[model samples]
Target: MKRILLAALGAISLSACAQAPGGGQAPGATASAPVAKPTVAAAQAKAGTPDARAIEAVRVLNPKVKVERVGAAPMPGFREAIVAGQVVYVSDDGRYLFLPGSGGALFDVQAQKNLSEDAMNVVRKQLLQTIPRSERIVFAPTNPKYTVSVFTDVECGYCRKLHSDIAEYNRQGIAIEYLAFPRMGIGSDDYKKMVAVWCAPDRRKALTDAKNGRGPTNASCKTSVNQQYDVGRRAGLTGTPMILTAEGVEVGGYLPPAALRQALDKLAAEQAPVATAKPGA
Candidate 1:
């Protein structure tokens, strides 16, 4: 799925990064034809790394693009900002914005790496790591093997169906860690109802009941519903039941129990670390 665009045109306007994360950088993974590095102001580049002014410049230029974090790009003289949850590089002076979103343009010559998709995967894994187990509404068997974090909406038909098969999933040793994602947006009825579910005294039962068409007894109390919704958005959740392997591989949609287990099995195998042969063996 890691493809180069621009001899790689046929470019779609939309940049949806999905699929297995990129492997080790490709051979000759180095910055291509060198261009002149922009002349950065001495005070700016040296002050606190990705200069505040540079971040402000990015914000000023792309007001709509949500700038999460900014730092030095793989290549010198370029500042990288995690804009709108995608990796983009801004020239040192902050005039040019380099995008890896356009397919293979992602390769960072100096780093011998793909900055776009590869960095996205890295970012995904990092963000996922920040989530503590206590924040998740988990359903697992006594003995668990694999775990997947799912963004769910109680009102979504597919979400409801997924929850209906929770037991089968548990039997297969797949733990379902649920996060609230009210697709109807924060103020709609779905959001309030889900908030109630999270606020309920018996969270596990409340989640099950809500998914099964029962209303949550209490919709009061501060809950992490809002924060979870934000996380879902950053994770590119377009719809309910957006499943992801523990490795941060996005499992597109609802897969029947068997298929889901099979998918997870393949994912686990893929993520399994290779054993280095013993010197004597």
Candidate 2:
């Protein structure tokens, strides 16, 4: 899952073209910026609607970038712009823009992308409701404080590390819901093994047994196992042990219970601050 997330983000970063102000002989625009300004009507339409404006702004800024769609973010006055494989953000007035960064260092572009993704988290939260709870392997508490969906693979070493500390996660008010995503796609031994575990009468025990190196007895049963795979795919997931928070935050790999708890708390506390206009009349 880590590889997939990194790869997807990388692809998006590569697709973000340099935004050059004005048309013709601008500082950054492949070879050069165009000489003409964006159409007046297009700018007005984009400005009136945050979503529409963000889309139009990207097109005007970089005609080479192929934008597929535009939508509202979790916060008001913010817009999410999707350009083919990449995603970006634009302010309501279409004045500010952000892109993802490259390399291990978090550049200006990466910081902007993080802010944008944070604002769009609600979209991911909505997807959780589409799947029924019964179909999931739930590690729920009587009075749950927090819930997280985890895409796990039986064979992954870090997954075992997470399972080993399952009690700690539970004690921290973190309820874990397991979803299958065989690192190796169907036809591999790992995939076949996970299927057997899902088919077992006692799902919890079957998973435990499989993780302990004992292959589950071959069995057949209707389950939402494949559905989980599809969900991962749609969410741009391509690997195992993908952890998703209820608030729509995604942590790609294994995290100690304490660290995970701390991260969640931080996310919960950081609400978007209201932008203030100038005080002078």
Candidate 3:
């Protein structure tokens, strides 16, 4: 099961990388800034706790890189730090930093579980929730059995294909909440088009038209396109049609309606609460 899961995720990641235009950075690319390093005294003051120490270790490597959050990792003697939306582990004593591929991932051999990916899933879930449903362009069924958030680009081919099948997905009881993620960056034509779509009187129709190559009508409004793009970036989106489960798990890239429904059903089953019987019964 672990191997199958990893293979599926790997294929999806590759697909996303290939679909992204303008050679956008990989998922979880570090967002660097021209920030100055903390003084020794300041670092010392904040290094009393394990979280601070872990954060300090990452800062010591490159002050320009942002360290968003730090917490205890599932691995013993290490702390998980969310640096620029990527998960990196630092030694509890602030000596070592374990990047995903560099030093290998944290896995539970006994349980066949990838702890590192689990941590990242939590981060994705939290970051995704920060954008409320009101801010998104939603295409949902009257009664949805599953709702998936998608980071989408207006001009991406795969994204358009997914949108074309939007009705099929809705028929399959899958609600799709679309968030703008213009691969060409903010202020680009793609961004403008998405803004137009979001600003349209009927976003669902406007989005469908745009996806079908009708082009968005000329209009402007105070839309959340920029904010949604930022959130997608922080959530490690590398391409359009980046589908994420309600629990923030990246099942894979574009899937046919039936395949998508199957995947969602499997996920639902896995996440369902297990029934426990009363001892006396």
Clash-forming residue pairs, model 2: 1-239, 1-240, 23-34, 23-35, 24-33, 24-34, 24-35, 46-53
Q: Please write out the lDDT profile of model 2 over residues 120-160, one tens digit for every residue.
A: 46666776656688767777667767789988889999888
lDDT of 1 by residue, 161-227 (tens): 9999999999988899998899999888889889898887787888888888886734678878888
Compared with the true structure, what per-residue lDDT tens digits does model 3 show for residues 150-178? 99887999898898888999999999999
Question: How many residue pairs of model 1 clash at the backbone?
Answer: 9
Model 2 bad stretches (over 4 Å): 1-120, 272-281
Give the worst 10-residue stretch by lDDT in candidate 3. Answer: 5-14
Ranking of predictions according to lDDT = 3, 1, 2
125 in model 2: Cα distance from truth in Å? 2.5
Score candidate 2 by TM-score against the native.
0.58
Model 2 vs truth, CA RMSD:
12.6
- Per-residue lDDT of 39 in model 2: 26
lDDT (C-alpha) at residue 183 in model 3 = 94
Q: Point out the worst 10-residue segment of candidate 1 by lDDT.
A: 1-10
